[model samples]
Target: MYDGAIIMESLRVGTSLEAFPLILRRLSRYAVKTASADQPPVWTEFVFEVADEHAVELADALAEVLDQPGWYADFHNDEENFVIYPGRVFRYRRGDQLARAEAQEHGRTLGVPEPQLDWTD
Candidate 1:
C-alpha cells in the first residue's frame, strides 16, 4: 500500500515574528514530526506530514501566509522539494539514491547552493 503519505522534512518557514502564531495555527491540523525554536535570531523549523494530495494546498497556504520580503518555505517530500529563497524545485524518488543524486545535480545546475539530496523518513 502506498499510504499516500507525504513526509515534509526540514520545512523552514521564514516570516515576521508576529506571523508565526498564525502559521502554526494554520498548520496545526497536520501531524508535526519535529519543531524547533531558536532565540536571539528567532528561527524555527517545522517538520510535518500530510496526505500527498494535500501537499500543494499546504504549500499555497504557507506561501500566502508567509508572503513577505524575508518570508519563504522549504519542503521535502518523495517527489520534490522547494527552496523558496532561490525559487527552485528538485525532484527525486523516495529511496533511489541515483535519482536523488541526479536531482541534486539538477538543483546545482539551477543555482541552489546546497540542495537536500537525501530521503526523509
Candidate 2:
C-alpha cells in the first residue's frame, strides 16, 4: 500500500481565509485540520492520507490554489515532493535539490534534500 500527505501553508494576510472552504471542497477526500495549536492560529494545515493513484489529483488541486495570489501549498509522498506557489508548482524527488532557483523560476518544484535523521547514526 502507498501512503502520502498534502500540507498547505497560507499566510494570515488579507482574504486568505476566503480560500479555505474552496480548497476543502476541492480536496474533500482528505482529512483536514488547522495548525492553531501548533502555530499562532495564523496558519492552517490540511492533512490526509492518499493512495498512489490519487497523487496526481491532489497535486492538481494544490496547483490550482497555488495559482492564486498569496497561497502556498505542497504535496509529498515516498517518491517525490512538490512545492506549490503563486502561478506554479515545483516537482522534485525527496533529497534532491539540483537547479532549485531555475525550478522556482520555471514554476517547478525545487530539489531539496530530505532532512537527515541524526538519530539514525
Candidate 3:
C-alpha cells in the first residue's frame, strides 16, 4: 500500500449520482478504482497520496468519516489544492476568495461552506 490520504469532500451535497464521475477524474492520477455500492445511493472507491506518519493519521480520520453510506475520501498533497465544484476551486491560503470573485463576476451560484477547507483544520 502507498502512503496517502483520501477526502470525500461532502456527505449529502447535491446528489451522489452527479458527483462520482467528476471525483474519479480529478484523482485519476492516483489510480482510483470503483466498487459496487452494495448499499443504496452508490459509493465509489477513492484513493490518493500523503507523505508521512501525520498524513497516515489524517487518513485514518478521513476514513472514519467516509465509512458512512454515500461518502468517500481522498487526500492530496498540501501544496495541491482542490476544485470542489465546477468553476469553484480552493486552496489552503486564500480559502474561497478567487472562486467567490469569479462567481460574483459571472453571477454564478456557488455551493457554500466550501469543501476544500476541512472543518478539522
Number of the top-ranking candidate, with TM-score as the measure = 2
How many steric clashes does model 2 contain? Answer: 5
Candidate closest to the true structure, highest lDDT: 2
Q: Candidate 2, residues 33-114: lDDT per residue as tens digits?
A: 3322322333334544555665566556555554233344555666676655544656677566563444444432322212
Each prediction's total of clashing residue pairs, residues at least 3 apart in sequence or on different chains, is 0, 5, 10
Report the C-alpha lDDT of model 3 over 1-121, residue by residue, as the tens digit: 2223343443444423221212222342222233223223332334444344344444333433433332333334444332233322232323456643543332223322223223221
Per-model CA lDDT versus the true structure: 0.39, 0.42, 0.34
Per-model TM values vs. the true structure:
0.37, 0.47, 0.25
lDDT of 1 by residue, 1-121 (tens): 1112121232334532232222221222343222222111222344444456655555554544442223335455555554332243333446666665665665445443352223352
Deviation of model 1 at 21, angstroms? 17
Model 2 residue 10 distance off true place after TM-score fit, in angstroms: 3.6
Q: Candidate 1: deviation at residue 7, Å?
A: 17
Global lDDT of model 3: 0.34
Candidate 2's C-alpha runs over 4 A off are 1-41, 67-70, 99-121
